[model samples]
Target: MNRRPLPQIVLGVVIVVVGVVGLLRAMGLVDLSLDDLFSTWWPLAIILVGLAALVAAPRAWIGPTLIVTVGLLFQLDNLDLLDVAVGELLWPLVIIFVGLSLLTNLGTRGTDDRTINSAVIWWGSARRTTSQQFEGGSLSAIMGGIEVDLRQAGLADGAEISVFTFWGGVEIKVPPTWRVQVSGLPVLGGWENKTVPPADPEAPVLTVHVTAIMGGVEIKAGD
Candidate 1:
């Protein structure tokens, strides 16, 4: 019969302990705050587990363990630790980690396919005679696309609108009567505006400034 090495046995024991503890915590039998665990003991745990894994399965787990250890170290707020561990080494470490993860998962794909291709669509319109105002927020639209229609909305002065897209497009349609000023490079495509009516001095002003990379963008008047 083959005997497992000491390091492998230790890793197995540690993993079993961690799994039991996590299960207990999830079932409310243990009263441990995830935040405290992650901010305090988790880093040390990660380091120890990583070291043990490196010794037991150097070919399989060394890279992942190192990546977790480094990430945990970076999340710590200690300036001294950051200065020593990061300093000029931050970008290089990030590049190496990303490259290795990509290489390791080269053949594995579609684990998060649904989230990768998700989008958001919104529609709102009002008559110009109404005193109602239109308001919108982009916090929910992060990392995805958002389509907003305000052409017929009876926009009031001081109406608030914010668009935040991390890596996708944002399309806003408004009456051409409103004055517009954009101050950001949105992908390679240019902004599109259609002719409508003269600007209403009392009408709310529409301001849109979006920042993105490699994401196509288009904005025009919505009828």
Candidate 2:
């Protein structure tokens, strides 16, 4: 699997463009001043991050899109271009969005749940499934935490899993020999894969699809 960070690339372009625009203004080649441009356009950086997240993983785009909408509204309000108070709308919209998100697909989700071993948690904090031979399963941590240790586990060539964390976090421990692929959209959150690639260079691939909102997911080398 291609491990290139697409979001980083997009963000780099945005930063470069903004810096170049500011330089042009300073050189008297543009109409707007540095302050005016920064104040009026800097919020776009946040919106673009959300957009990149949505593009990276469409399956869980709502969280990122909500973040984008809120940011845009706030920026407009700050620029005196909006009449209504966007702040008042934030909490209500967040509640509604969370409700809809849960109702839509809050299952023991995976590429194929019925065919794999798994563990899922909704609230509080706990974990399970210390399988010695894990073969691709879903792990969810919502408004809580979870830890999965699969150091001794085994996987087939194309095994995959989906992890969703909302206002929560998850930690995964995997064997060093596994070839892992991590993909996700993070809204006020992060997804990090710290597992080292095996020296053999022909390890089995384990694809992890994730959705993170106000939370985080991490993968670490184990055993």
- Give the top-scoring candidate (lDDT): 2
Measured on C-alpha atoms, candidate 2 has an lDDT of 0.67
- The CA lDDT at 32 in model 1 is 77
**After superposition, which runs of candidate 2 have C-alpha atoms over 4 Å from their true positions?**
1-4, 75-83, 108-169, 175-177, 183-192, 199-202, 209-216
TM-score of every model? 0.36, 0.65
Which one is best on TM-score? 2
- Provide C-alpha RMSD values for all models, in order: 20.7, 5.3
- Stretches of candidate 1 off by over 4 Å are 1-131, 139-143, 185-204
Estimate, for each residue in 83-148, the C-alpha lDDT of model 2 and write its tens digit: 889878887876776576555445554322332322233444333344444556555555667676
Model 1, span 44-128: residue lDDT tens: 6555544543443233332335445565665563324454555456567656644553453344123221111112313221112
- The alpha-carbon lDDT assigned to residue 217 of candidate 2 equals 90
